[model samples]
Target: MAFVAELSRSVQGRVVLITGAASGIGRATAHVFAREGARVAVTDRAQEDADRVAGEIRAEGGEAVGWALDVADGQAIETVAAAVAERFGGLDILVNNAGTTRVLKIDDGRYDAAWDFLLPILLGSHQRMIRAALPHLRRSEAPRIVNIASTEALGASSPGSIYSAAKAGVTGLTRSLAVELGREGITVNCICPGPIHTGMTAAIPDDNKTIYARRRTALGRYGDPAEVAHAILNFCLPASSYVTGVTLRVDGGLMVRNA
Candidate 1:
């Protein structure tokens, strides 16, 4: 087989389930995988948005279906995971990309509420989805688990302590799960995106975004959701069979600077 053809065929006919796929990086990931010929399960807390994304993929000539899933709920994760496996015939890749940003001070009234609200979705949900999808993943010839963490996991931002902690936990979970599932051929990995132009960062002014990118990242610009989506795609490719437990930073060189 030709090298390029083999690479292109790697992810073809695979089944991929992505959480929080209604918008941002998750949405981009859904489209990318579907374009690569994967049957996609587009899931989110908002049913309409999820369905809209699925519809868009179908209009683009890809196989996809939408499901309303609240990742924070363990039972919901199990139910959705099973339904996706059944709908798509079987599961192959699971992307835990559902999350939000919350900044809270230790003395704030909502500090405890922030922890309660964020941890379950950002950290716990990854574990829940992995467990729920493990059975189906084990049946596949090339199974993969990609957990979407954030650069916050590697560095600290004031008042984002809780969010950072939760994301950090995600990377830890990825490493541990990778070791446990290595012998089974299920590769687990983590992606930490930085300065992405997503809904979470939409509130930041353009000027500030520019200045931050210039001063921080080596690329000197904010990354698009599709950029991170493609990084996620790399791990899902069958060619990545030997790669596991990797915490990749799709940060446009944000982590490499000291100046």
Candidate 2:
């Protein structure tokens, strides 16, 4: 009840857009933001999952809507941005959370495939969405952009993950945009999440998790999607008004050990 009251004071009546809201961190973020009274736009490639997230938020007495989106398509992003503006009267927050990658070494024949797919989804899409959503974001008094990167972006030397390289671009974009948008009173930051216990990492064996915990993480465990969501909510809150253009890592000390 205390947090509920605080939600009303901190996040009530804001319009929020989150990509990749079908599952994992994006889904957790949708719940967190919606609970705090934001009018959440739950968009993902999976129509069923996106609909369910929005439905659940509405069922819980929060304002929400769902749309199937391919973040790699800039035109589609523009269309969705327009729809959100019309439906919500404006936008206050943007969470660019959709991402993917293929594991391929440069020597592999499929390296081009990995590069093409990952770059568009991870970096190109985030940039396009920002361009499409800028006008609506500019209208808000407290506009916030939370670009999701990865701990790999912080120079993790993750040779196994093509996603890591793309995320580095996202981190760069976050820093640059923070400066460009600062004059507009819009705050831009990034979340470089570590190895979270999400669907994408489900294939990692228990042994590997144990090894990673012991060797890499000071916290000695994997992170949860909700944990990353909490960091994201921190950026969107009015209390974080002074924090901008920073990459906050939610990596459970993976970077600390590696660094």
Candidate 3:
């Protein structure tokens, strides 16, 4: 009973705004924050799904609000930021989790259209959302930003060439933002997830996922949403004051040579 209360009060009253909260990692993250008593602002491209997630959180006795947010649209991002701040009175954490996977080859003439569509949601949206939420976040004693990157960022690009490039930019953004925001008591970090089975990966046939897991990951299995959430939650807690500017890979030990 005591443990339960402690867990519940862990992030009590903190305002967390998570983009792409409609499903997958975003939905999982929303549950993580709410379970710990944070007032979560759920925003996604799909308004109905976002609302359902928020409703589920409220039904579970947590505070939350849902808003339709298309990160590709600058104005929509601004509107969501304002609505989130007003709804929660302030914002403490911003999770840039909105992105999509694309199977594209760089040499193909299709590169132009592909880059244009993926860049904004994957890499560009991070800064835009951060700018819109900075004023409110700056007001909080403990502010955090977690950008969701991909393992492809480091690996030689194959399947998602565009996604890989964009995520690499996200990693760069994380480092730069951490250095800049540290003095302001705002910690910035990023996660590189390898083969986490989300809505995106689910589209791939299970046999293919198994083959990839065998080839790439030492753990020989895909991680669950909650597993990634734990790593994210750590950086979010006030206890993580000393930890900043780190790119923690939540992959099941997908080998990427640092040298």
Top lDDT: which candidate number? 1
Q: Where in model 2 is the C-alpha error above 4 Å?
A: 1-9
The per-residue C-alpha lDDT of model 2 at residue 92 equals 93
Best by TM-score: 1
Return the TM-score for candidate 1, rounded to 2 decimals. 0.96
Candidate 1, residues 1-259, lDDT tens digits: the string is 7565344336889999999999999999999999999999999998999999999999999999999999999999999999999988999999999998788888999899889999999999999999999999999999999999999999988989999999999999999999999999999999999999999999999999999999999999999999999999999988888899999999989999987
For model 3, the superposed segments whose C-alpha errors exceed 4 Å read 1-9, 256-259
lDDT of 3 by residue, 77-138 (tens): 88889888887788999999999867778788888898999899999999999999999989
* Candidate 2: Cα lDDT at 59: 92
| Superposed Cα deviation of residue 128, candidate 2 (Å) | 0.5
> Global lDDT for candidate 2?
0.89
- TM-scores, each model vs. reference: 0.96, 0.93, 0.93
Worst ten in a row by lDDT for model 3: 1-10
Between candidates 1 and 2, which one is better according to lDDT? 1
Q: Per-residue CA lDDT of candidate 2, range 42-135, in tens?
A: 9998778889999998999988999889998888899998998899999999999998767766688888777887798999999998998999
